[model samples]
Target: MKQEDTIDFHIKRTWQSIAKMYNEEASKYDATMATGYVLLNIDKEEGTPSTSLGPKMGMEATSLSRILKNMEERGLIERRKNPIDGRSVLVHLTDLGLEKRADAKQAVVRFNEAIFSAVPEQKLEIFFEVISKVNELITNRKIYLKEV
Candidate 1:
């Protein structure tokens, strides 16, 4: 096969591997990346509306609501009526949520270390640059904007 075809094949396999890994560790992912994102966003905007939260987390309204629900049940977040907009609700992190967020931060550091350790140190930067370029191309798809 051509070099381009080989690259494409490996890319597909790499993504499949990533998906499988996430599926296997689904529970750990939520409390780490999911919680970390919410915590960071909350730190930036302490009482953000659920509507805005979805965009920050790259999630749809339904998905964000589900995540919020799980976090709420875990005592990681709290919702209250927005005083400025009675019809809308705002999300805030409780003390427990902040503590969990701290833990999640550490978990992410360890997780990333384990993942990146496989890459040869000299090639790691180039690998990430390629990943970034691919992500940019994917995210800039005109068809996606049309759908939204």
Candidate 2:
């Protein structure tokens, strides 16, 4: 096989692996759950705008907006006019949103730790470096979550 084909094969395989992992945890991996998870990080200090959510989630604006509307109706989150900028809207997590965020965070932590614990300690640093280099070369965005 050609080098390009080999790379594509690996990429597809990698995605499948991740998706399978997510499927195994599907009850916790719903997009709505993620929306709530993301909401937990928002507050008066962060003051995240609803529009910024799409870029953060790698979703289209329309999809994010629809999800946001549903969340709003469910009372998980609330949007208010930004005090600093009238044009911007800030998203705040309601009490229930915060609870969901905490649960989602614990699930993510447990899942990721399970995956990382299987890796050899000595190779972990180099593994991250290699992935980071590949991401840097192909896309300007960062590869893994770094707590924003």
Candidate 3:
């Protein structure tokens, strides 16, 4: 089969396109798509636990650490000792972070609105279902199995 006809190829290509679009938009604010994603995941009010951030975002420890370090240097986030757990840390957004978070939120909302507006509701539902099944199959390691 042609590579363009494969499900994984389409999925990967679409994701790459979306990431590029998001990164271009984020550049205006001196942020990358990765940083914007992290900003959105962080809780605005109570702050998020440092260890939880990586898992929540499906990000690697090394990459998350570098992004967090850059954000801290830019005064976007502050790491404070976790009161509940002495060994862990809590990541809190500063005033600047809050502002950037709002910007990121708006960008996400706009993107969703544009897509949802263009796509039919029924088509969108089917798309979501297909994506969910793909995720489930991958999670369960069901792909590439030989038939009985």
Candidate 4:
């Protein structure tokens, strides 16, 4: 089949578009799309653990480290001793981080609202189902018979 006819192609293309839109918005705050996502994933009240942040965000250690470093340098996040886990550190949002997190949350909420307003609920449900099924196929390793 042609590239445009493939589901993966559509998924990748749509995601790229969405990432670009988010990046553009994030640029105004001197942040990137990844940073906005990270801010949103973090717990506002109780800080998130440094170890958990990577897996929670599906990011590798090196990349997460870079983002955390940049945020720290910008005074957005501060690493504090994890009371619960003595060995690990917790990444808590500073005052500036809290403000940026709110901005990120608003951007995500507005985007979802816009999508809901534009797309029919039933159609959106079907779209979600299709995406879920695709994920399941990949998770089950059913897309390929042998390791390439």
Which structure among the candidates has the greatest TM-score? 3
Which residue pairs clash in candidate 4?
A: none
Residue-by-residue lDDT tens digits, candidate 4, 20-89: 9999999999999999988988899999998999999889999999999999999999999999879999
Count backbone clashes in candidate 1. 0
lDDT of 1 at 61: 82
Query: Which of 2 and 4 is ahead in TM-score?
Result: 4
lDDT of 1 by residue, 1-148 (tens): 7765776688988868755554445455455455566666775345788888888778788877887898899898899899998999888888888777676566557668986887787698888898788778788873256543
| Candidate 3 C-alpha lDDT tens digits along 1-148 | 9998899899999999999999999999999999999999988888999899999999999999999999999999999988888798889999999999999999999999999999999999999999999999998989888889
Q: What lDDT, from 0 to 1, does candidate 2 have?
A: 0.71
Question: CA lDDT, every prediction?
Answer: 0.73, 0.71, 0.95, 0.94
lDDT of 2 by residue, 1-148 (tens): 7765775578788878766665456455343454644665566355578877777777788877887888788777889898889999998877877776676667678877986899887788887887678878668655444694
- Candidate 1 ranges beyond 4 A from true positions: 1-41, 81-88, 116-118, 142-148
Clashing residue pairs for model 2? none
TM-score, model 1 to reference: 0.64
Q: Candidate 4: where are CA atoms >4 Å away?
A: none
| Ranking of models by lDDT | 3, 4, 1, 2
